[model samples]
Target chain A: MASPARGNHVWVGSETGILKGINLQKKQATNYKFGDAVLSRHEAVTTMCWGDPYESEIYVGCLDGSVKLFSTEKGKFTESRDCREGEGPFCGLAVLDGSLITCVQSGLLKVWRDTSSENVEIQVGPGVCRMCQNPEQLHRVATGGKENCLKVWDLHQPQEPIFRAKNVRNDWLDLRVPIWDRDMQFLPGSEKIVTCTGYHQVRLYDPSSPQRRPVLEATFGEYPLTALSLTPDANAVVVGSSRGDVAVIDLRQGRLVKCLKGFAGSVRAIQCHPALPLVASCGLDRFLRVHNLHQKRLEHKVYLKSRLNCLLLTSREKWENEDSPAELQSDVKEEEDDEIWNSMEVVATKRKAETQPCCESGNKEPRKDKPSRKKKIRKAES
Target chain B: MAEKLGKGRTSQKAQHNAEKAEAVASPGEGQGAPVQPDQVLFPPSFSVSEIKNKQRRHFMFLRWKQQQRKEKLAIKKKRKKEREALGDKAPPKPVPKTIENQRVYDETTVDPNDEEVALDEATDEFAPYFNRQTVPKILITTSDRPRGKTVRFCEQLSKCIPNSHVYYRRGLALKRIIPQCMSRDFTDLIVINEDRKIPNGLVLSHLPDGPTAHFRMSSVRLRKEIKRKGKAPTEHQPEVILNNFTTRLGHSIGRMFASLFPHDPQFVGRQVATFHNQRDYIFFRFHRYIFKNEKKVAIQELGPRFTLKLRSLQKGTFDSKFGEYEWIHKRHEMDTSRRKFHL
Candidate 1:
């Protein structure tokens, strides 16, 4: 599928061995299945990102355990089956300087990039997903998974992370933190990450200084905050919640800008315009709302048909100022005709019934197994 | 259910004190509230033996949580700028300690083992229920406590409606003194029990008005009377004997308070065991402290129509124990939550 960001082009890698360029401007885009149609297994798209500058060479992660390279130039994709199956079920894919970092569910992360001699590329791996190149020291990169401590590998000595940051033994830190780290932030233009827990407090940490404690923690919300996004400038963090309340915590002030409330469900995803202060959040409410982080009001709401399991927002503009309340009120009315919101009642009812288990067979097992496991792991490990 | 429940209309409100009920109670006792005919009225009465023993631990835990959160916030504010400048160079500062008093209103456990343990300890000296021999001279109405456990729920008691005066003074030994204040209005001498305002169906404890203590007291008093008279005191020993005395007094004073007397009852609840065969009613879940030692104390709820369900106590327990008296059961039903210490 086309990348959700501002770029007009996308690297579409389909399960049918199809790697193609899909133009958003055109109604009829071209398609080319990289392999014979008969060999396609219709695998799930594991991960995809705008991995290139020109927006070409779409990196497609597939469940079948391989990354496919789709070129917009050829209008077709090629598979790097060189990586064996089960070696990765890469859930995350990010591109830094033409080098690819793939985060697999099995806790293994690999970096693939060209070395000298151009085509003679090095595929370094068997490491965790804590991979990030030191902007100050390009040769020095780090890798860690949620399960393993981070290890920094210099192109010269690619062994372990430079030094272990004595993080609270939380599973998320134990592994490379998630794409949306709810607890804290990683400082801008640096390798520092922040985390928060218990009453929605934020804590900042710089792994470079592992033994030292965090720098700042801004507390907000009356309950547990479930999601967080950085303002494009990285000065303030837009925190979201287990309840659909959102707030902007200005680090300079060490206080919450506002506690925004509207949605009835816990927030699941948060994204802000790269330049514009507009923030888009979607959650169990199934409604994607765009708000001016400053005005902190519902600007636009796009009703999705699902509970909005996940979303990606890509904007090129930077946020400049706060929004006015009057503008927000009018924008909210425009969403009244939103058909996605029109189906919410029915969707909620359907969801409720499916969630409750009917006594099945003669043997009625305790319904708590899955629910308990999730609760236990979250409370114990996280 | 809403229509069936009548509102509270008390004209005479009193505070509790270190005295027996018969001494403070008029023939028609209460907060001088006229008992509504349709409502089952009663006092907020229960066995203090339950909570004084089994549930203080849980109450203490909640107090600790409140204290921790307060300290954490204060220290954080003081160290904010300094720490941010250090930027991970220095360790995070610890939470400060500024918060003071916290209160608790919930009590879950009231089993025999714990009460027995308490009975063996200090309660035997202070509470009369354990021995079922001593007539308790003091009735302590409390909401909850925190100021280092040095005071009763006096803070909460002050908030008790019918806006009353409250008191608090540690004893000579620096022991906790449940504050009781004197007043001239409806809340006069009223020390409100703050526990009533709690959010949940509060598992509250009070001085048990059970027949066990009454039975033992009555039996012992009557036994001595028969021995002194050299004849068997009649079947209705205590009731008959006390009635002659209180009846004359109940009516003459009834005339004096004719203008102040209650016409209706304000209470709710049917008979049910809450803590293992312990009978409790919702009506009298709140009580009154009418004119005692110049300091009146009472227990009352904050809202109307609090929903609650019984946990372990059964319906038949009271029946089997006091099977001989139909009036006791009827009165128990009416008495548990009824406000009609009816004239």
Candidate 2:
């Protein structure tokens, strides 16, 4: 586990196009720019996940429309093979049962079970915004997207999705599975799923409950919820809002536990360690904060220079090596040069930077304007 | 007489040898002139044919004596060379302590914040074996000489180990319900356990690392050096016995505690209630635990991030088990318990 110390190891991906790993142990960071090559090769790392159960593996989803698999054991860009095959930028990724599932912007879903097939691709669309699987039965799959659809595929039969739920989402096109409904599995099992949205509310539904609508709908008074996580015990729901704060809702009592303060930007994602009751939240502010649920203390906070789009923490001793934050030996130095180009352009395009990039450009900027204005008015009063 | 003579024979020879050694040494001082080549010369005594033989024999004897002299000189020179080398490289002679560097020992002068935090964190981890700084020991009379002596000893010892508790045989009847309590060690405190169990919660970590826990009162936390399993030398009798005893104790404790928690407890520790010098065990439960090792991470928030690998051994004499990292820590906790053994 990354020790939640002030210097805890963290992976920071810059808009300039480089993913750097931070090593809190050595008080150093090793970073390599996603070269015009690795960036153009596998550009725009929108999501980052630690792969290979032992942690020597790293799966990065690039907006350049490629899911690059890097091996820390081999200590270099293992290979920047285009898993999406120039389909489009990869938005999110999840590693299930030793197989890697990636959601791309072009509405294509691909699975790389192992390092083989540098050019293999699988297409499952709604522009696969997010992906998840039923842990109880690995065959049950859930893929959500821009079309307000949640397609559950049982790989046991790959040609057809076991069941598809339509009109599940109505807002943003990008969707990611931030929580698992382990409670929703059947007869002595559960299937309840709780999902957060760009739509200012969190909804819970049980596919097995045979209900078209959500069983529970949790809404926030202010900005839309960008990220949220349910406590392992399912007693509370922690949501990160567009207005830069993390709120803990006690579901049993149906009241606010406590809201953490001090982030300048919106919260992106929230996750809880299975064995730790603590809540970990990351977002536009690029700070990873861990809160001790019982003690109600934000135990530690690690600041990053760039926005954190997604994060997955599994027990891996070799995780920080994923980017080798401070490794001078990496041949990927060209990545930093590419990042320099992106950040400099972003610097020139502050107006666009203000507009959420994850929401995509042009149309979403106009849409994000109203909420950000409301946030400013509310911040002034609060 | 022969037997007696046999016993004293080496000594008698030694005594005579001493005399001979003395004789050889007395005139060997610098004042005595060293034998030179010219000091002793031989005269020729022989007839023509007979003379050749006699002269040859005499010459041989002279040559032999000269060689003996050379050998003696060489031996003497070698001893002189050895003494000179020893003078240059021999270890410095021990000098009696001058008492200049020795100073009065005082532990209270450290930064209180860091000390408190470190002690709290460590004692929290090794909670069960911790001896706290508060809690005054009220000695009871029936508490035979041993009990009172132990209490007095602990009063001084507990200052060193911050998480430990000693009841000290207070004559008060063992009551099941008692809510009233105060920190009697001249410190401000309050009651924790509403039940009759010990006031201190067994720190799943309140354990000392082996015998190192015994000296914990000095507030120095030490980890026991675990010898690599396969490489440990087994030829020594003491090590073999100690290894077997600790191995069984560890396996038994791990099994017993694993059953108690069924689920990984918030805390970890082994509890020993000593009465009549015998120990009955109890496992400490925790409020929270954070563990990170190789392979699996069983976080409370995520459950088990990876497959939980736990290896356990049932209670059977002479049983030793090497489990996964998860069980290894628990077994470590078990082995940490102070076992009553013949010192």
Candidate 3:
């Protein structure tokens, strides 16, 4: 599992009920859709998790309260099961030692045993936005959302949460701070769990500490801090806001290091490469962008037409050469050239013909006459 | 006649003094006493008829004329004294400070020949507090491998947006196109990447400044699905309706989405952009109106209707691996309920 050459496929789930596998080596993407006729048309893939360490089996949770199992190697859905009705969409999904773990927006966390009909269920709290499992301690998961403060649940205990975060004291205005943890992540080797809130706050809470409140808190953009990801080095956290502002915050100092700009809409999901100094992000803008964290340059960008919901980054190295055939590359380039020329030719020819004489004459007469003609048309219409 | 006149003058003087004494004693109620003397002196008395003989009448007329002249002289002297007391100053101008007494300056009083007052240049006093003005110009283009469906989707999508322009991504590097787009003042760029002739990937880059986001589109159901559900209305032309976005953020988001489509549709264009929400998922549908004549019309599928689910959003360009990059995940959580979100 620790090997670096395991796979380089980036799996992305979309609102259109399709799962896409992007082969980094080949620069190719393949879409996988379930063949089941009973699937609801409006059902969107909400949450996904790897079922096995080999990264072959994937469990997908849909908005329609159904969980489906897919084999990455086979590229087909193998099993599907309906969750409790009216649970809303799955807010989080994970796999712990062959048991399927799922959490819904209404805060019903369930663990389904592969062989037994019985399942373990716990109510984390209502309005739960996200749940994240600690890689080191798979049984421990953190859940938080609106009115649902941070809680660390140990699956083996199956009772009360091990750690429940208390709300911070009222702000300087003496107003109670709202609890809306949009995203959370566990530090690599520490008990500290960092959570980003809709209030644009990033807070680190150590369950081991005596205090229930966050040990450190920092704010980012003014808009809701929709999503956050831990840097590979674990020294910084990347946070995105509803207004499309993304920034890196130094965890030790609780200060923003830099901000990343270029988003028109709200940011939805972001991920940092586990081993590489790379970060891949997707959003309502529907473009998958891979940025080099060290150089702060966009390495690769692919436009996926539909709004993406979630993305999974693989550990396999990027395909720099050899996998993408020369023929396909050339073909892609030709098609792109043709597209540009088709649109540009029309505009360029027309503009050049019209502006060439105007430039040669170096007079404002032609420009003035153009408006006069338009004025005459308006007069005629009137 | 002289004795009668003397008696009348003595009574008038006594009445005036009585009114003055009343005014001094009861200031509040004395306002009514000054009016009573005028009412009492106006009527003529018949007791004066005895002085009507011819010679006596002539003497009485002379005496009356002389008394009237003396009264006029006294009034003139009194007025002169009052003027001297006031130091010959001009009459006090009325100050309209109270609501009832306030004056409204009418536009008609303005001097037409007065030079036009120059308006102060719009200050940036509120600029820091207010969101910057962004022109909603969107550039719709396709990915390098342009499929027919994706190209057509770009065309139809561009039409839906009011100030959008569509061009195929002819192998033109985004770097090159971005400068061009910036020069053209395009605020947004939407890239449609196709897989297997299906609109698969969507890249929306905010120009000049960007937190470019990529989305994966799936479960595309065209207008045929709406028609099958019997939800398509009987209209000759396609109409885009964005519904159920109630909050200010929702409204602005809806408006931002609506601004992506052209405000005025071309005569031949029939597509509509409908963004309706149920729960939290906003469903985007594009439909085309097919009409044989004026009477019978049918709805046809133009562009692929799909739902947009946010996957990831990065802060700047996709260059996170090099220097430093920050991003956020689970952006969809912010869209769940409008009440809690400030955006």
Interface RMSD of 1: 28.2
Give the range of the ten consecutive residues with the poorest summed lDDT in model 2 chain B.
B210-219
- Lowest summed lDDT across 10 adjacent residues in model 2 chain A is found at A179-188
Highest-TM-score candidate: 3
lDDT of 1 by residue, A1-382 (tens): 2221123222333333333332232322243444654333334354466555434456666667766676543445655644332355554565666776665655554556565243212233442332344445555554444334434455544444444544443454466332222333345687765444434666565666645444565677665565667788888777776545578877666687776655544565566666777776766443556787777777665433223323345442311110222322322332444566456778646633543332131123335476887899999987
lDDT of 1 at A378: 94
Q: Which parts of model 2 are misplaced by more than 4 Å?
A: A1-9, A23-29, A32-42, A72-76, A85-88, A113-128, A166-189, A251-255, A316-382, B1-343
lDDT of 1 at A200: 62
Compose the digit string of candidate 2's lDDT tens values, residues A1-382.
2222212245545433456555544545454554444332125467767664445567776766555665554444555656654355555566777777666656565666666674234456644556665656755656665544555666656677665553444447566433211111111146656665555556665677676566666666455566667766676787776556577776555467787654444565676655567666766544566677777686666654344566544433332333322222221342335566456775636633543343244345568898999999999999
Each candidate's chain B TM-score?
A: 0.16, 0.18, 0.42
* B132: Cα error in model 3, Å: 38
Clashes of 2: 60
* CAPRI grade of model 2: incorrect
DockQ of each: 0.01, 0.00, 0.01
- lDDT for A257 in candidate 2 is 76
The parts of candidate 1 lying over 4 Å away from their true place are A1-48, A54-91, A113-156, A168-185, A196-201, A208-211, A219-226, A264-268, A307-312, A318-382, B1-343
CA lDDT, candidate 2, residue A7: 26
Candidates 1 and 3 compared by TM-score, better number: 3
Q: What DockQ score does model 2 reach against the true complex? A: 0.00
Tens-place lDDT digits, model 1, residues B1-343: 4343223212222212211432322322332345454665444343232335456645544543454465467557757866887897978565664211121211212233542222222221213323344321222233344242213233322222223234442221111221221112121121122223433222111112211100100011111222212222111101001121121112211121111112222223211111111112122111222234567643322212222222211111122221111011123323443222211
Tens-digit lDDT track of model 3 for B1-343? 9686565555545444543454222221222334343454432222112455878756655654555466568668867777778884945645766522232322212132422100000111111112345546788888787876667667656544666788867899876888899899887778777788888777666656554555567666543443443333222234558876553234334444554443344546565668875433567776666788899988655555776543444444333222112233344544343333221
